[model samples]
Structures are given as C-alpha cells and as structure tokens.
Target: MATELRTAAVAGSGAQARPVILVGFQAQGNLGLGYLSSTLRRAGYCVELLDIELPPDDIVAAIRRADPILVGFSLIFQFYIRRYGDLIRTLRAHGVDCHFTMGGHYPSLSSRQTLTTVPELDSVVRFEGEITLLEMVAALAEGRDWTGIPGLIHRRGGDIVANAARPLVEDLDSLPYPERSFAPEIVLGHKALPILASRGCARTCSFCSIHTFYRTAPGKVVRTRRPAEVVQEMQLLHRERGITIFLFQDDDFPLFGKKWRAWAHAFVDELHRSGLVGRMIWKISCRADAVDAELFVRMRDAGLYIVYMGLESGTEEGLVTLNKGITVAQNRLAVQTLKQLGIMFEFGFMLLDPSSTFESVHGNVAFLRDIVGDGSAAATFCKMLPYDGTPIKDALEQSGRLKGDVCAPDYDFLDPRLDAFYQALARIVDVTGWIHGHRALTPQLNWAWNELAVIRQLFPRLPDTDAYEAALRNLTRESNDLLFTVVENVATIFATGKGCEPDPQALRRQCDMALSRLLHERNAFMARHQTVLLRALQQAAA
Candidate 1:
C-alpha cells in the first residue's frame, strides 16, 4: 500500500528521477516531514514523502525503488521505535545502504538510547528537524562533517555524540508552508488541510511531552506565524487545491488570553479580510481556560465549526495533580460557553494515572457524565501512558512506580482492587467495538469523524434531500451509546469490589454480546449511508 501510494505521489509530482526519500508514520498527515520536504525541495533536493503505515515489505520495496541516498524516519511515538528499528534492519539486509536517520518526540528525548539500541539508524535529529535535516542532507551529499551540526546525534567510532540543540525558529513567517504537494492524497477529507499556525505550547502540562521537547532549546517556548502569513497560506491552499476545510494544527490555537489578544485580533481580522473565512471551515485546539466567548463568536462567524479542548480531568484534585493550571470550574465554564454559542466541541480526559484511586476514578466517571451526559461517547477517556521526557514519567520513575525502561514503561495501581477493575475494563474495551488493543478510542473516533465530516461536506452539495446525514449522526449516537454502556458497567465494578459480579465471566460475555450487536448495526448503517451518499454525490455532480 505504501509503495503504491509513493508511486502515485511521484507520478503526481512529475518526477522522472529517484529522489531522497523521507519516511513518516502517523494516523494523520506527517506535518513535520511535510515541512522538511518543503524546505529540502526548495533547496533543490528531490524528496519523496512516504508514510510508513504500509507493510514492512512494501516499505522496503518502495525504498528500493527510490534507491535514494538518505532515508529518514520521523519518530513521533516510542511505540513504533522497535518497529522502525526492525524496518531499518530489513532494509539493510536487503542491501539498501541508505543512511537511515530518525527524529521527533521519541528520538529527541532519547537520542543516545535510540542510537544505541537501533544500530541501523545512522543518526537521530533532535527537536525541530527542518534545519538540522537540511544541513545533514547537504553534508551527506558533499561528504562534509555532519557532527558539528546542532540538534543531531550521530554514532562516532564506538560511541554516540550528542550535539547541541538548535535555536527555535523565531521568525516562523520566514518558513515556507509545508509541502503537501508531494503527497496530496494525505490531505484529509479530500480538501481539509492540516496546517500549523504556530509551534510548541503555552502551558506546561505534567503529562505532555511538548514542553519537554521544546525545553531542549533556549528562548521562547511558543512561536507564532504572523496573522497575514497564516491567511496567505490559507488563500494559497484554497486557490491551488480547492481546499475548503483548514484544520489548524497549533498546539495552543488563538493563544486565547490577554497575552496574545493583539495577535488573536489580528488573526481574526486577517481571516475576514482574506475572504478565505467565507469559503472554508476550520477546527482548532486550545486550553479550556484560554477560550473567550466573544472571540470565539467572531471566530464562529468566520467559519469555525469545531473546537477541541484538553479537559484532561474532571476533578480539581486531578487537575492539580497533573499541574494543568486550570480549575475544574474553568473547565465547566469553557464547555458551557462553547455549548451556549452552539459550537461543536470535543475533549480529552485522562481517566487513570499514577494518582488514580477508586474515588478519583468514580469522580472522573461522574464528571464525564455531567459534561456530556449519559450515552455521549464522542468524548473518550484514556489511561495516561508515560512517554519519555514527561514530568509524570519522571515522578513515577523517582517513586519507583514505573515497571519498565524509558522506551516502554508500565505502572501499577495504588489500589489492587482499582487495578483489577482497570484490567477488566481494558480487556472488555479491547474486545469491544469501541477500541482495539492498546490503541486509544479517541483516535479511532476522530478518524471516523473525519471520514463523516468529509461526507457531511459533500451532503450539502447533494441536490436531493437525502437521509445520509441523519444516518451518520444516528450511527455516531449509537456508537456513543455503546461506549457509555461499557463505561457504566466499568463504573459499577469500580463502585463495588472486583468481585461485585457473582460471575465476572458472565459480565464479560454480556459486554461482548452488546459490542457484537453494535458492530453489526454499525456495518449495516455504513452500507446504507454509503449507498445514499454515493448516489447523492453522483446526482449532484450530474
């Protein structure tokens, strides 16, 4: 699949020759690699952007076909570290001698460990990869010393040398827009482009690695693109690609407070002046406390449809423990304001963490219910996974709660009963229609929502009054219903003891049956809706 995708991308780009190939893996488009590709190509280097979601053999085949000098993997998560390591080995075994390098969150945090463990990786670019990668590519091409390059870790002799970190790009407007043209298929929902209006974040959440990654450098933690510059990219994407949906991939969008009020007003004003706001809808993420009702109203009037907030926890204690710097009241107010303004919003919640107890878990459950109510599954909760460079992980390690190495860590519950209940809940959720093993439910739902959003955008283009939109919404409600049912069952076990049910296996079987029924219903719904949507699209086009 990856090979085919790469070939299609190359053909689309009208490139007749092999080029330097950069690999990236993500559920969404790889914006980091996109930025790198754009920079390198603008410097006159041929670059091919390949997503590593394809099978290993396909990846090897694609790289072999390219026969490029360098192959860099953007390592965003530790989960894929081992997988990419094996891939590098396979590529080497196939006599592909391309210099393999990796960069992103995991590599930036554990460059030495990554290089030590993954011997096949020639180097690891730390932090923001654009400048470092460009310099490395130049050095590799000209046979120059890449060791002096900042923000790089390269194996030298018997040891790995970690270089100094590169300074953050202060003038974000100086950088060109990411190269989406190399892989246009990566565009979400046909025309929805994932764009970053800013980099880094404002707040330092204990559980997040963003601040840690940025902390490696000196100076301002967050950087912004000029409002005019951002608007210019929107206009360009709209004019060139007919894109109508702009998903701002900013860490803290609108910077929603007094500190960035001038920037915010300028951005909103630019959106209005550019006339791009009239033609496109946008989605963004921001802190719960950062949002302002008045500013959001203006934004909504400028085609803002969705807002994603990191609610993280429901209890004030949980928020404090995570060092989220926002109160529970603030979270409530934010949700209420968005709701009052008729803006569609989604949130993230960490249900279980190192400090989780039965009481806290119960509070979280109640909080989630209070916010979204019963049968609202769009907002999903997750167990906090400790990534490298997070304060939470450091605290867990210091307290000896972590059970594994830095690459992969595990934590035990303070309460054995709560642990048992969590295990059971995970087992049921893994087996249910809601989630697959280890993968979070939110990403799955987000993927589904993106697909549906694309279809919804097309629905209005349909001349006939079709029921597909209703079907899609009904499917979402039904999915959420199943999620809430599972949540209630899990809550019951948490309330009572682990032995609350006389037969635990019976409860598991019931959950399984319910999930099976839901999956069957969902399949039928998709079939019905797809037929209606396809017919409508065809008719509208005619």
Candidate 2:
C-alpha cells in the first residue's frame, strides 16, 4: 500500500502545505527520482515517491492514495511514454489534476512532442532537473510566473514555448545526497547501493544521445564530484545502510582520456584516508583508451572488483563506423592489462551495426574468441540500438533507412542479407529465451558476480579458505565456459546465416540444451553451498 502524503513546514507563517508526488516505473531503483525527492525535502516541499512496476491497477491505487498537489514523472526511456500517458489519463478521469511535469532523457529531447501528445502533462522540465524542478514547484505553489524560468517547456495560449537552456550545475557537491532510504520496498537482496561519482560522458560516440543531450547546455560535458565528497558519501552509506558494495553509475566512470589519472589517484587517496579502502568494494565503467595498468592496480587494491569496458567493436572499420575513436589494438591492450593485473572485467560488444558485413561479423566472432576466450570472463554483444537525437538515427533518417516514428525508430541494415540474418537470429534467441532475455548470459554473469561478492565478505574468516577459493575458481571457470559455448553457437548461426543455409532449428535446440544444463548446474552449486556460505557470513560478522 502507498503511504499518505506527509506535510512539511514551508517558509512564511501559516502556509498551507502542498505535497509533491514523483511517479516512475520500478524497473530498478529510480535513483534520479530518489535524488529529486531528497532535494525537494531539503527545500521544504512535502514529497512522496510512487514507483509502479507490476500490474497497471497498482499505479491508479497509489496515485489515489497520495492525492498529491503536483505529480512529476521521470521520463527516461521512450518505451514507457505510452504507459505514462495512460496513467495521466486515468488520473484526469478521477478528477485529480493539480499539476503534471516530466523530465529526463526522452522528454528533454522531445519536450514539445510529449506535451502535445500527452495533453494531461502541463509542462516538461528540461535537462538536469534537480534545481529547475525545485524552483518550478515553489513558483507553482505560490502563484508565480514560471515561464521566465530556464530549462522548462510549457503551453502558453496555443503556443508551446521552451525557455532558454539552463546553465549546467557547476557545483554538484552543493546538492543533497539522494534519499535512497525512503524507498525500501524496491531494495534488492544484495543491498548494493548505486552511487554516481560524476554525471555525463565526454565521448561523442555517434550511437549515444548523451553528448547531444548536453550539446544545448553551456559548460563542460562531464561534471564530477570532489573525491572527498564521494568517499564521504560512501562511508556514510557503509555505516548507516550496512552496504558493502557500491556501483558507480557514471557514464564514463574512470572519466576519459588523460584527465582521469589525477582524479583516480585523488579518489584512491581519499578512500584510504577515510578508512573506506578495506571495508567497501566497487565497480565502474570506462572506455578502453582511458585505462592505465598502474592506476587500475591502485584502484584494485582500494577495492574495485569489476571494471566494465565498452569494447564496442572488434574490427577497426566497425569502430570507425560507430565513431568510438579507439582502435582494436587499444582495446586489446586494455583487456590484456586487466588480465595481467588480475582484475575481473567485462566487455560491451556491438557485433552488428549499420556498417556490419560478413567479413566484420567473422572478425567480431574471432575477436570474441580471443579476448573473451572459451571460458574466462563475461561479455555481452548486441546490434546498435538507435535512439532519438543520436547521430546514427539522424543519418539513418536522412538516408531513408529508418522506419517508425521519431520516438522509437525501426532501422533496416544497409545490406538486406545482413538484415535477414539479424531478424532470424533475433527470432531464434527470443523463442529459446537463452541469449538476450532476462535469464540470458548477462544475468547469469551477474548472479555469479554477486555470489562471489557475498563469498568474499566471508573470505577472510573461512576455516578452509584455500579450498573454498579453489571451489570458487572452479565455479567461475565453469560458468564462463557455459556462457562462451552458448555465445559461440549463437554467433555461428548469425555469422553463417548470410553465406550458408544453416540449420537454425538444430542450433536453437543446442543452445536451449546448453542453457538448461548451465542453469541446473548453477542451481545445484548454490544449493550445495548455501548452508556453509550462510554460516561463514555469520561467523565473519560475529
């Protein structure tokens, strides 16, 4: 059940409290909304978060229970836009329309279209909404002109006007830490908290909308927190929430290019200075070009367990097509460096894109075999997905290769044969529910990763530490073997689909059998170790 709106004391005498409700899908924890809710509370506006993930009926029930004066939806993905529209209509039908606003990636780019389409949404807040939303809500509460406010789009007597883009928040440290404590129902078992050390990426990857999203605003593309502030926040979460693992949500966590070295050193220094080095473990994402072996070693010692690198393509031509700006050699070096340093890493590969061909696909498969190997590490590969306001999408539009609306474009390959293969592979994978589905390779990898984390918590005190470590190593290696075998078989089907009349039915059956075996083995391993693992954890804590 949704909680009732609690009142807060606003400025001035006898001011009637007007509560704010932030609505979003609970796919994962809405950290953006969490930050917004905290910021609102700091400014004295009563706020409640209504995150609906399950049945549609729950959404209406939550909205009715809150009965807020203002509702803000965090519109990040275009897929959810229709669902949000339905939600707004339901609220309006119930005669509950105080104010409706939305902000995030999708709305920031298509504000006019969103407002015009979803008539119930009164206004759309533009990029970096924390400050803009706080001010907008305050103005709306006191009957002030919000039109002058920068970073807002609203309807004005049959005219949709978008105010000037607001300057990027220079001092990110001034903002309140996101209120993660308020949304307890959605918290997962691991108690792994997601923290952002920085915002935005400096890369201009043609496939990404991040760079374009920030192009309108004036200032540096990437904004980072002072290292001390980040460590302090981590320490606080560690102490208060009993969270031992932190996941850095920065687009390019190691920061990018030559600038990251100094920042990394300072960050590691603070981790040690604050005594958080021994207590907490973290994971981050970065580009291949930005990795330095020595810097990574320091980070590993300071507790970085996993590093996710975007190795978008294996062939240089594919890399160039995506505008990744890094060579295949650079990616190899980064992967080799991590392997040498004994750091666990994963790769994000794009095997199929606008420029992918038979030769490139073969090269990508070979590359996967080399870097990823038969059974060692975890990696995920997929075709490039186009989004609104990205360079690739724009190019596709100009070339007439795109179908569907601007919100969600369906793209065709440059080569019809390649398109056919992709479609066939997609169908097979979807039907088998093994490759890219929720229970696919990535989730299995995540489960192994998380299980190891729990095991590591109890590593220091286990009576048979050496034997236990051996068992973990064996499990990890076997897990990777299963993942790689499944991936290779799937890749063969796609890589050969264009040239030969491969038996996709046979291939799909093979994949299903392999995945079923892997899941059964994994479940057995977990069941076998459950009692001992729990005991070890308890012993360590005691």
Candidate 3:
C-alpha cells in the first residue's frame, strides 16, 4: 500500500528538486532527529533541521522562510509536549498551513492521546519512523492518499485513525547513515556527534520505557549497522562536520552477545584500514555483562573513550525485582574491567525501587562506597520511577500497591520521598569527593546536595541520613534539620484529622514550594558546576 513519489525535474534545470524543508532537533543532541533527517535526505528530500532548543520566534521565522510543504517535528522528551503544541499554534496563527507530523518515543507509545492533545498535528508516526516518514513524504509529494501508509495516525472527521504498525527493519545496515549535512553548522555547534550502532535492548528492566517500544513487535528483532558502515559514518562526521566526540546512543550496544565482539573487531579493523582510527573519540551504553577487559581494550584502541553501564541495583533481590537480568557481581566486574583498561566510564545506579527497603538502600550505599573507593570510579545514581507501560507499573498496579494515577506529573520516576533521599546521598557523595580532592565528583555532589536541601524544605517529614545509619553520619545534622520539618508537618496533618478543618490548598502549596525549591537549587548547582564538571571529566579521560 506504500507508494514512492517520482522525482521531478525543475523547469530551468535538469536536476531533480528535493523536498525543501524538514524540521528536527539539530540542536538538542538527540539521535532520533539525526536518523530522521538522514533518512529523509537519502529519500531525496532537501532537509533543513530545526533545533527544538531555539526560541519560538526563531523557529517560527525559520519555518516561515523555508515554507516547507511538509513540517516534521521529532518529539523525544515528554517534557517538551506542551512547548511543541505552543509552537504549532504559533505556526497556525501565522497562516502557515504546512502538513505537521510528529515522531518519537511519546508519539510511538501514545499515538491516540498525542493526536487528541495536538489536534493540529496532521499525522503521527507510530514506530521506527525512518521508512514510514520516507514513504509518507513520497505519498505527500505525489499527492496520493496516505490512508494506506503503515505506522501512521491521522484524524478522520471527529475520530483519530491509526494504520497498522510497521514491521521492524531487520537489516539495519540497509538504511543510509543518518545525514548530518542537513544539520546547520550553528545548530551542531562544537559538541554534536551522536550515532547509533544498534537498535533495541535485550534486558527487560521493569522500570524502563524501552520495552514499550520494543513490545510493538515480537521477539529480539534487534538489528545493527555493519561495522564498516558504522565506521564510515564516523569518518564522514569527522571529515565533513568537524565532529570529534561520537556517542553511540544505543540502549544496549552489545545486545547480540558475541556478535558485538565480532562487530567491534571489524570496526577497529575498518578504522585502521581507513586510516582514521584516532580521528575521533567515542562513547557507548552497554550492559555490565557485555563488557570485559579484552573488549574494553579493543574498544579503547578503536577510539572508544567511555562506556556507560546501568548498574541498577546493588542487591540480587533488587536486580531480580527489576528484571535487570544481571547481577551485582557482573556490575563490579564491568567497572573493574573499564578501569583496568584505562577507559573512562559512567555508572548508572537506581535507588528507590518499590521493593527497596532500608536494608537494600543501605546496601546500595555500601556497594557504592566499595566500588567508588578513593574517587577512582565515575558513577551517577538516579531514583527509580514507574514509567508508563513498564512491567513495574503493571505489577504495582495489579498488586494494588501503586498509589495515584501513573499519568500524574507528581508520580514521576523520582517521587518526593525517594527524590529527597537520593538528593541527600548525592550531595554527601559530592562533598565526600571534594574533601578527597577528586574534582570530578564535586559538581555532581554539590548539585545533589543543593537539590536535597530544597526537596527537604518542600516535603517536611521525609527521613534523613541520621535516621538511617552511622556510616553516613557526616550528613546527619543536615538530614535531621530536613527530617524535622517533615515530622512537624505530619504532626500538624494528624492533629487536624479529627475536628480541625485544614485548607487543602495550603498543603498543596507546601508541596509545590518544596518541588520549586528542589528545581531552583538543582538548576543553580548545575549553573555553578557544569563547566567544572566538564573540565574534570575531560581531564580524567586525558
């Protein structure tokens, strides 16, 4: 049911005309937009990528000048949905009647909801957008009815209609490397080298949103670009775009087991063969089980500078509860391997799972202390949240333990209680790092502490470090001050339960103030420490 538009020659020239404009996140450093722009250009569309981070007026002016027949917006983060809607409204107010289409994680999961919210959106691409969007542009260019295009959702009269979801692309190598040339020089700036070597993850972590997308299709239909193709793209980015830092934005780079090893070997061989082995430095996300000393050495030799691993929990039970499919042992080994290889790494840890108890929380701290000994390891911790469509949310909902609606903004991955704890721990960790004179951990720790203080002020009765154990006594006093406020507020609420009428708005305001403080403090910390953190990271790698 898919149709390809025939190329048309211009009146004055023999060359064929390409679709004039394509808007995407050229400035946001997102891989989805890069893929879309590249695929569209390969399909013979003249693409102009727009950065979502730019001002609304600037975006509007660019769109007006381009006067594109097709305006494609790549939606990656749910946080930007409202902002995108505002921009669309602006475009409409300016009498720009271009066909608006959206693609990305949010649209892929909740197509109907997205269409309902952004009624101005002419269509939404449900899943893997490269081919779907390419086929759509062809149909639109040929003036053909697009009702038959798979993975498309359109508004029909008063109803929203979705075509069948498209099949996953099996041979990922067939797709052309994402076109970076379409991105504006200013938009790319100095740090814009995002690449993807593989697609889909094998692990079924209960709290992750990745499953929501992969579940659309059956089985482990993971695909990877050939090693030569991956290396070629890197060379092109370096030679043409002046890009040096290549980040492999895959969920799990080594999903195909030993297949990744083969690819890594081949990739290194290809880089050496092409004489561009040292032209760029690269980073990739991988499971703890995927890396080893040998593999790290190979990757580092081939310009792989950083490896990001998700060490979700420190306990076996926590790992099982989250269905991470890996153990704490593997996580430790992975970190050790990276360190031994002299390759930089970033460790991801998640605290505050539904099953997490005080024991598990303490275990996490112990595990961190052991692994991050003397500030030699680089790691970051985040609080767990039950994202929509994840098994964790489903299990919690089924067990009747998950309170409130999952769609509520307040129910984000980092709930207030856990958020405060993580913030405090992060600050303690940062301050500890600073005391040790490990500059790399200072910014991260300062940011974490400021955030903890803000969240503590906002949510009065949350527990603090002193209440937990003596090991974290360094932060005990600060924790007591934060926890006392929480206890006092709880006392007030309980005392008013019988005959005293309490204003709900007052309680809500207190909660809102806490959240605002957390946000403000976190931002201030980042503003103060971003440059220092970047410098430390750079120097550590050097």
Candidate 4:
C-alpha cells in the first residue's frame, strides 16, 4: 500500500470534481485540516471545510450544500470525543449520509478506543493524516477498499482491525502549502495567519503527546523545511494576502540542538535576504532550554516579536517528575534572556502536576511570581491532565492513581488537601470567570502585548508608546499578583486544614477593577494613535 501510495495515487479523476468536506476546530488555524485540504486539492480532488464552531444548523446546511463524498472530523483532543460524536450523530439524523472519518493524536494513538467511542466513524485516519486521508478519499472515489490501507483503523466483522501505520513524511518541504481560506485571523486590526517552518517536536515531555505521536510511526521524529522555502511562503502570503503577523504553529519551532539551531540560523538569514526582516513580525513556541540571547537577538532582528515557552514546573522535583530535563534556573534564565532581549514571552505552566504536595504547590506559585510578577506576560495555569498517549498517563495508570475514563482523564494529587486546593482555585477561576478564557485578564494582556508588538514594529517612534507599554505591563503585574495572592491564600488555608469559605467575589472585584483600568489605558492609547495606525495599515494594504 505504501508503494502504491508513493507510485500512482490521486483521489479523483472525474470530470465533475468530488468534494471532500473537512470539519474541525479552526479558531487558531486548523493546520491539520489546512494541510489535508491542500493535499487533496493538489491531487485533483475538491475539498471544503466546515468549522465546528459554527451552529449545528449551519454545519448541517453546509454539508448538505456541498454534498461531499466524505466528511472528515479532526478530533484532535480526546475530551472532544463526545462533542464530535454528538455532531456526527446530528449529521446522520439530518440525513447527511456521507462517509465519516476522524483523525488526530487521540484517534491515532488509541485507535481502538477512538473507534469504540466514535462508532459513527467509518474509519480512523491514524497518525500524520495527509497521505492517509488522501488515499482514503481516493479509494472511496475509485470504489476500492480503503480498510487495507496503511495508517488506518476500521471495524471488520464486528471486530476492530488496525492496519500497519505509514512512516511519517520525511520531507516536510515536499508537502503543499496548507490551504487557509477561512475568514482571516485578525489581530489588533492587522491580518494574522499561521504558517509552519517545521513539523513535529523531538522532546518527550510526560504531559505532551507530540513526541509519542511522531514516534508511533516509523520515521524521523522531526522534519524541517528549507529556510528559503519557508521564507518564500511568507513572502507569498505577505504579497498576496497582506498578512503582517506570521504565527508559526509548529509544535515547537526548530531551535534546539546543532541541526535545529542551524535551521534557525538559516531561517533568520533567509528572513533578512528575502527583505522580510523589517516588513513582518512572527511568533513561535519553544522550549526554555533553547533560549540563547545571541540567537534570539538575531531572530528579533528578523522580526521575531514573541516567544512562548512551556515552563511546565518550578520545583526541581516537579521538573524532574515531569521529565522536563531542564532546571528552574534554566527556565528563569530563558525568561530573563527574552525579557532583556525585549521580545515578549508567554509560557505554559502546570500549577498542579501528577506529583504535587502543598509545599511544591507553593514553590510553583513563587516561581510564577518571580517569572511573571513583573508582568512581562500575564500569568495563567491549570492542573495537568494525563492525556491519552503521554508517559505520565502510563505512570499514573501503573500507580493506580489515574482517575476518570480515557476521555477527560485526570488524577488526584497524593495529598487530598492539594486536590481541595486545586478545586478551590478552579472554582475561583470558573465562577469569578476573569482568569483563563479569551475575555479574561490573562488573554486580554496577551492580546494587548500582541498589539503592542505590532505598534512597536510599525510605529517605532510614536510618542507616548513607551508609556502605554509601561502602563499595560503594570496592569499585567497587578493582575498576576492578584491571581497569585488568591491561589496562595487558598493553598495556605487548605494546607493548614482550616475550614474556609472561599469568596470569589473578592477575586471578581479585583479582576473587574484591573480590567477596567486596562481597558481605559488601552483605549486611551488607541485613541491617541488610531489615525496614524489606520493610515499606516491602509497604505500597507494598498
């Protein structure tokens, strides 16, 4: 099948094209579907996307309107299984009876569970989905059996059968550019879009399934595109679509080790050579250990405005437990390096890891204080979930501490009080409601920082810009302190075994106050410069 796929495989040859409908989360550019869609279209098949966020009626109507031969669901997370199942069932009820398939880490890593849970799916396209999905669609169009294809799981004779998986695509550059025709992702009145310079991550963090997902197949765990090719794509997008903000959605941008470091340098050089160094800005997510002042400075010169690192834990024990293989000192150094570099940084943190005690929780909070206390970035966190294909999940299962089912998997801390503390904190975040979501202070500050990055790049000499940034940073610090104080208080009460009535109203009041001030400052800055900003943007678009 692999040989056949590599040889002569294109989905449709009919004079009237057959449309393959892809449905998935597209809030942040669903590159999974984007790539798949491009692959199908490149192979002479039509593809349409139905964003899952749309109302069910609209989704059903769109499917009906397209009348695609196959509907592929991008079930990226295990928790969304029920939601996808319900959606699939709804589709069936509406008499939309096209073939249905699902793909992603959850469906790939646990095919049996995925098939069993989402029984409505005709098959699961496991692992890297481009070739598998394309081949499946081709087989369906050509009236050939797709069940025997590589990288597929399907039901046969009331029993689930898993076929051999295809090796990961070794040459990422060979793949067509991802198809991105959705409504433009606008960031602060500037056009934004996601692009990829590489595919896959080499790290084996316990809570992350990326490494496992890549290693599940028999190929390179990571693959890179030529730097010139990446720059060419950026140039094309900037020229054709007027995209000024490029968000590299690679699992982690290739910037670690000798090979990846060279790739990063080549990328920077290409950015400069292609005349995009001063014309565009981009963001990337990377590991803390990958941060080097010199390399980041070069990247910043190449229009790198933001760096997001996953600093999973603070305590040495917590870091070791999570298999981070980096030190608290390294994390701090990375934060300070990027801070001094003046490149905005955000982070992913786990307030509660699988191994947690009251003392460690406090240590984590203190770490958050030191890193984000200055409000360079807003602070936010949640307890880590043992996802389907992570080492920590297996360990939790071995220790008999893993709770909940495969979907919505969770584990209680060894200390019951820590669990209580987590619940109280969750209640505060959920009820007071100004903490984690898009409209919350954390995300608000994140957006503000993004806008500031744009302004800093476009209008470098604008008057009072520095003051606005300083004001935003102060608001961020206050917001971070408010969050830290609330969490610490809850932790202390829970640790000392004190009966306490947690009042989220206080949290609500503080958050509301902070948010009001943030909005006022942000609005004032915008009002002061909207005319110039608008003119600059309009000319750029022109």
Please list the residue runs of candidate 1 whose C-alpha ends up more than 4 Å from where it truly belongs after superposition.
1-18, 181-190, 374-377, 405-407, 435-542
Best by lDDT: 4
**For candidate 4, what is the TM-score?**
0.97
Cα lDDT of model 3 by residue, 1-542, tens digit:
12221221111122124354555556536567666766666555677777777788998998887777688888766666777888898999998897899987777887887887788899998777777777777666777877788889898888888788887766777666665543432211233467888888766788887867877754354666788888888778767666656767888885336767887777778888977665556668888888867767776787776677788898998899889888899888888887687665667777557776545766776677656643443334556666555778777777666665424422322234444444444454343332224243323433344233222221223333223222222232332233233323333333344233234345345434443544455465445555654564354234
TM-score of 3: 0.72
Off by over 4 Å in 3: 1-24, 181-192, 218-220, 399-542
**Distance from true location, Cα of 180 in model 1, Å:** 1.5
> 1-542, model 1: which lDDT tens digit per residue?
22322332333343324467888774567788888888677666799877788888998998998898689998877878888889899999999996889988889888888988799888998887777777777766766777888878888888888788877767776565888743343323345678888898878899999989898776577888888898899889878777777888888885666757678878889998997765677889999887788888888888777889999998878898889999988998998888788676778889888888777877887777667663222557788888888999889888878887655677877877777777777776665434443234434444545544444444544432234434434555555555655665676767674534234455446545544544464456566556666665455334
RMSD of each: 6.2, 4.7, 10.7, 1.8
Q: CA lDDT of 479 in candidate 1?
A: 56
The model with the greater TM-score, 2 or 4, is 4
Put down candidate 2 lDDT per residue, 378-477, tens digits, no spaces.
Answer: 5467888788868998898898888876455678877676776777666755655545767664456555555555455424444554454445444445
**Which candidate's TM-score is highest?**
4
Kindly report which residue pairs in candidate 3 clash with one another. 38-179, 385-413, 430-445, 458-514, 460-485, 460-486, 461-486
* Candidate 4: RMSD to truth: 1.8
> Which residues of candidate 2, in runs, are more than 4 Å off?
1-16, 181-190, 461-532, 539-542
lDDT of each: 0.73, 0.73, 0.63, 0.86
lDDT against true structure, model 4 = 0.86
